[model samples]
Target: MDFGLVLLLLGGFLLGGAWSIWRADSDTEGRTGPQVVFAVILLTAALLASVSGILYLV
Candidate 1:
C-alpha cells in the first residue's frame, strides 16, 4: 500500500470537505466561488502530488 497516496487523498478530502462545509455554513453567499476554487486547488494539488509520488515509487 502507498502511504503517501493515502495521506494525500485523506488530507485533500478533509481540507476540501472543510472548505465546502465552512462556506455552506457561512452567511455569506457571495463568497462560495472562492471556496470552491480553494477546494479544487487543494484537491488537485494533493492528487497530483500523490500520483507523482506513487509513480516515482513504482
Candidate 2:
C-alpha cells in the first residue's frame, strides 16, 4: 500500500470539497448551477477516496 497515493487522493478530495463550498457560497444564488455540479464532484471524490482506502486496508 502506498501511503503517498492515499494521502494524495484524500487531499485532492478535501480540496475539491472546500472549493465547492466556496463556490457555492460565492455565487449569486449561492445554491444553484455550478454549486450542485461541484457538490457532486466533491461527493464522487469522497466516495473514491474511501473505496481506495478500504482496498489499501485489505
Candidate 3:
C-alpha cells in the first residue's frame, strides 16, 4: 500500500468521524463547544491530509 493511499484512507475516516461528531453535537442541547471545536479541528486536518495525499499521488 502506498503511503499516499494510506493517507487518503485516513483522511476519509477522519472526515467521517468529524461529520458524525458535528451532527451529534448539533442534535444535543446547549454547551457542546468543545465537541464543536474538536470536530472543526478534525475536519481541517482531514482536508489537509486529503490534499497532501492527492498531491503526493500526482
Better of 1 and 3 by TM-score: 3
User: How many backbone clashes does every candidate have?
Assistant: 0, 0, 0
Per lDDT, the best of the predicted structures is 3
User: Model 1: how far is 46 from its true place, Å?
Assistant: 0.6
Off by over 4 Å in 1: 1-24, 27-31
lDDT of model 3 at residue 2?
91
lDDT of each: 0.65, 0.68, 0.89
Write down the TM-score of every candidate: 0.52, 0.55, 0.87
Clashing pairs in 3: none
Model 2, 6: alpha-carbon shift in Å?
A: 3.1
lDDT of 3 by residue, 1-58 (tens): 9989988998999999999888784334853989889999999999999998999999
**Global lDDT for candidate 1?**
0.65
Residue 6: error of model 3 in Å? Answer: 0.5
Instruction: For candidate 2, write residues 1-58 as lDDT tens digits.
Output: 5875685579577667757575657444557666677777777777777677667667
